[model samples]
Each structure stands twice: as C-alpha cells, then as structure tokens.
Target: MIKHTPKQQELQNLQQHLLTTLHRLCPVSNGAAPPPPGEWPTTRQLAESNDITIYQARNLLLNLAGRGKVLVTPGPVNKSLRWYPSL
Candidate 1:
C-alpha cells in the first residue's frame, strides 16, 4: 500500500473542500448541458456566478491557476480568460 505524509493528506483535504465549495457556489444550470468534469469556468461566468466583481474574480482565478488547483482558458472574445479546477 502507499502512504501519504501529513502535509500531503492535509493538502488533499483542502482540495476536497475547495472542490465542494466551488460546486456549491456554481452549480450547473437546470436543463443546461454541463461541461466535462474538471473543466474551468470563464472569468465572466465565474464573476456572475459568484456575484463578485470581474476584477476580483479574475485575480482569484489566476491565483488558483498558478497554484495548479485550477486551469485557465482564454476567452474566445478578446483576451479574457476562464478557469477550471485541475482534475
């Protein structure tokens, strides 16, 4: 069997909490198709869903992406971006 250090276990727990929070904060819409699992949300979408200002959402998403907890995709229009949790 494999073993995990305390820190690794804690990290895993934190990731799980984050995932749960993300889902609760941004549930898939009724009768609307959902993205594949682990796919990130667009910056605009995230902002609207979380009810935060676009600037704050962008910064949060970028920080999550940098930590490897989330992935980011450039928006089709202009240079905006989207974010998803890393699978």
Candidate 2:
C-alpha cells in the first residue's frame, strides 16, 4: 500500500474540489465554447472567473491539466501559460 502525508492529502482534496468546480462551471463537451478565438486565458483570467487567487488558479489549472480536464497551451505574451477546458 501507499502512504500519504497530511499536506499531500490536503492537496488531493483541493485538486478534487477544483475539478468539481471546473466541471460544474464548464461541462465537458466537444461542441462547447472554443477556447477564445486565438489563445487561452492567462492565469489571471482563470483566477478572476473562478474567484480564486493567482496562485490557487495556477495550481488548479495545473491539476486540471494533469487530470485531462483542461488543456494548457503556451501564452502568446510573456512566459505565462493559458488554460482551456478540454472538450
């Protein structure tokens, strides 16, 4: 069996919650809204829409991407990344 630290457990819980929220906000669908016309939204946009801090938004997006719930692409400006819900 495997072991999990308290911090790890908390992180897992947060990831689950973020996944649930994302699904509720943007249900997965092939015909759903395309990511913007060109590029995806920056971390700031995701945080603003989700009402979370930038750090939280980044973590949430990364988690979602890891779980295949969202697609992440390189941003056009700066070295920041963009996020789009996977359909």
Error of 1 at 30 (Å): 22
Put down candidate 1 lDDT per residue, 1-87, tens digits, no spaces.
779999878656644544455666556576565564345455666667656677866666666767886656644434566555555
TM-score of 1: 0.50
RMSD of each: 7.5, 3.7
Least lDDT summed over 10 consecutive residues: which range in candidate 1?
74-83
Put down candidate 2 lDDT per residue, 1-87, tens digits, no spaces: 789999988777766665566555545566756645245557776567656788987886787788887777754445667666677
Candidate 2 residue 83 Cα shift, in angstroms, is 3.6
At residue 77, candidate 1 shows an lDDT of 30
* Candidate 1 Cα outliers beyond 4 Å, as residue runs: 1-40, 74-79
